[model samples]
Target: MHWESRHERAPAVTVLAVGAYTVDFYIFGDRLPSVGETVAATGTASAHGGKAANVAVAAARLGGRARFIGAVGGDQEGAEALATLTRDGVDVSACPRTDPPTARSFICLDSRGQQYIMTWAGAADGLTADVAAAGAALLRPGAVLVLQGEIPVAVSAAAAAAAVPGVTVVLNPSPVEPFTQPRSDPDAARLLARADLVVLNAAECRRLIGERAGSTPSGLSAEAAQLRRQIRTATVVVTVGAQGALVIREGSEMHVPAPEVKVVDTTGAGDGFVGALAAGIAAGMPLAEAVLLACRAAAVSVTRQFCIPSYPRASELSHAPLSPRQC
Candidate 1:
């Protein structure tokens, strides 16, 4: 999204994100060591993560007014997560603290930008549909309500159903587990039907819809088209990472290439892309242009060593030239 200075009183593009918040401990450098082997690491640091929190931080960094709604524990990690979100200019007033310990993710990054993550749900597992409904009410009309798979399915569905008329509900079904069953829960299907856009990886698209995805050269595109046919209201965006991104809407398709950059960490690349895309859409940019902007932002994100830490500010993205190489 093209961001005017906040001081100029431009209407803020509010984003209400529903998901989890976790303490992320990152060990970056080469491949993870074997069971009995210990390898040297280039660096180590910690940050606030979780699909929702990372996306909210990404949006805020890209000049959107982002708010995060979810459950956290009353422990030190929870306090730190809240502080991190507030520091990033994300509204977290509606984020509650539960009795369980806060969630945590330990990430190990390889030199090629690939990452392996292990997460603990903690209090996030307890988030309910009621909490999502309450959170949805706080979203401003025309705002964007973004959801991911980290929270309870019922909660995500409720948030999607409660979106304001002019608001866009964006769903990202990542890590691709819960919806793998042959038959989806009626409530989940209803929620998917309400999404303005559904963003996922190539594998996720396959899980949602069967192998009947078309015969296109790009399996991702074929699957995206199949998914769009199933849920008529939602546009499908399947990210193929280094292969760029594919967008399918109303039977039309577009491919946006990913910018080239040296790999470092890809932990939050998808979140970065989706967050920027949502910000662009909320700012009234056309879908194609928004996807392009999201690609650029994601390319920038992977060049750095961490997830949220790698996201650039809006001004940085606005002033930067696009990279030449296509991923």
Candidate 2:
């Protein structure tokens, strides 16, 4: 079954991201600073960031009609974030306002593209479940609603609950909570139950479905079944860095390997994949084909640096819809 009516080149569909919004402070150095020790930085910069915000920016840049629904502060940082999203062609009208001093993240990037990020939750906490529901109500048929773990689980649940029947819910359970266990977090369970497609890294998937002895650890058939039993998701994709994404569905699994490229920064690569996947879904591509496109886009992202700056636009993907080997 397909999600939407496929066209030669489907028109853009709305991709709404409901989560946190923040500003990022990047400190680039030859190596990460040791505990309580200062290291000389090669360079420094600031930009708009946050899981949901990055996904929104990525979708818009990839030719999707993306919209961001989250809270921001009344400070200049918040204002700048809004302006940047606007410039990126993401709709910010549904975003709520909270106290001054928006959320912030301090990221330390090493020359090898590895990073250590420290975050400060500011006005992002003001984004409530009610606010998320209001934003989710804007979604229509064929729309894609993106959710992340950056916000409260209850808030994500509310957004998922409020999504229209035809809307495709994509959940990225980052920073995995103890929410997929026997005594799982109810709100988290609720959110997952509503997700049509669930995307997470290999580590997150292992954490989600408790690792067992002699297990593949990734989204192998057994682990995928455990995840499916936990949440009735139609498709669950476990991303392995460089190995591409492992797509698991009813009795079938396929590994989509990524094209090797020079690695610059691993930061925001997953966000780029999610954004590209959502855009492909909105454009009516098959799930496997969409995952392939996402893999390609993520490969492009890691060839650059930073978060939102690393996302690739639609034009950069030329011939993104490559035919998939039968899954």
Candidate 3:
């Protein structure tokens, strides 16, 4: 399956990211500070780091017509985040300004590229409305609706409901709250059921399925298939850092290998993967091929520091031959 041929044959599908927005402050140090102990940082940087915003920026940079539907604070930080998205070619016309200040995150990265993050939801939680409204206004047939767990469950649920018939929904259940929380998330469960595809990591897969995942090839495939049924989605993708990403469609499973690269920072790598995956789907690449592109994009992102700043544009990604391992 040639990428150019597939992309050329199908019409371009729009990508809409509807979720959270935050300004992240990163502190780089030789090592992460232990709990109750303060450690000095070697360097600090601030950037846009919300999952939804990252996805929008990533999709746009990868050549997708991407739009963002979320709220930002009426502050300089919020202003910068919106500007960053704009410069990255993400449509922010539907993003509204809210009060109580923008969201913020503090990330501490070690020399080995390991990181620990703490976030404050801030104004991201105060929005009176707009997520569903903007999503409804922009989403239509042939469009891709992207959602994440950073936003309120109600917000995600509303946006999912607003999606026009024929629109494809992609959910990335990051943070794994829906599966980790003691209380059941009906909204999240329903959203998962409605999604055409769901992307998560290995740990998230375990949490969702309420057990340990299979480590062996056959074990992974079996667990992934079980996870798909549990989530009630037609397709599910579980990303395994370094090893690659797994794609499970209905009952079949395939593994797409990650490109070898130096790791400067792991921040936003998953977002890059999700964004690139969504963009590839919008461009008409087959699921397995799209996962391949996504893995390549993620590999490129980890080679640099920061979140959105480290993302690679479509031209920056070297095309790798698609060779997905089957389960």
TM-score to native of every candidate shown:
0.87, 0.89, 0.89
Compared with the true structure, what per-residue lDDT tens digits does model 3 show for residues 1-327? 122223223223378888778888988999998989998889888877888888988888878878887788999887887888888778888777887799988899999999999888887776433555455555656567898888777777778887776677888987777545423777777788778888988878777777754455447667778888877788888898898998888546788999888899999999999998888776667778789989989999999988888888877875422111110
Q: Can you write out model 1's per-residue Cα lDDT over 1-327, one digit (the tens) per residue?
A: 122212222334367789988888888777877778888998888877889988888888877778889899999888988998899889888888999999988998877877779888898876778888888865655577998888777888888887767667888977666655525577667777788888987767877776633445456676788788887655888888876799888758899998877877788889998888877776656788778888888889888867778888777776432111100
lDDT for 184 in candidate 2 is 50
Q: Cα RMSD (Å) between model 2 and the true structure?
A: 4.0
TM-score top scorer: 2
Q: Sorted on TM-score, highest at the top, how do the candidates line up?
A: 2, 3, 1
What Cα-based lDDT does every candidate model obtain? 0.78, 0.81, 0.78
Better of 1 and 3 by TM-score: 3
Candidate 2 pairs with clashing backbones: none
Model 3: what TM-score? 0.89
- By lDDT, the better pick of 1 and 2 is 2
- Angstrom error at residue 112, model 1: 1.0
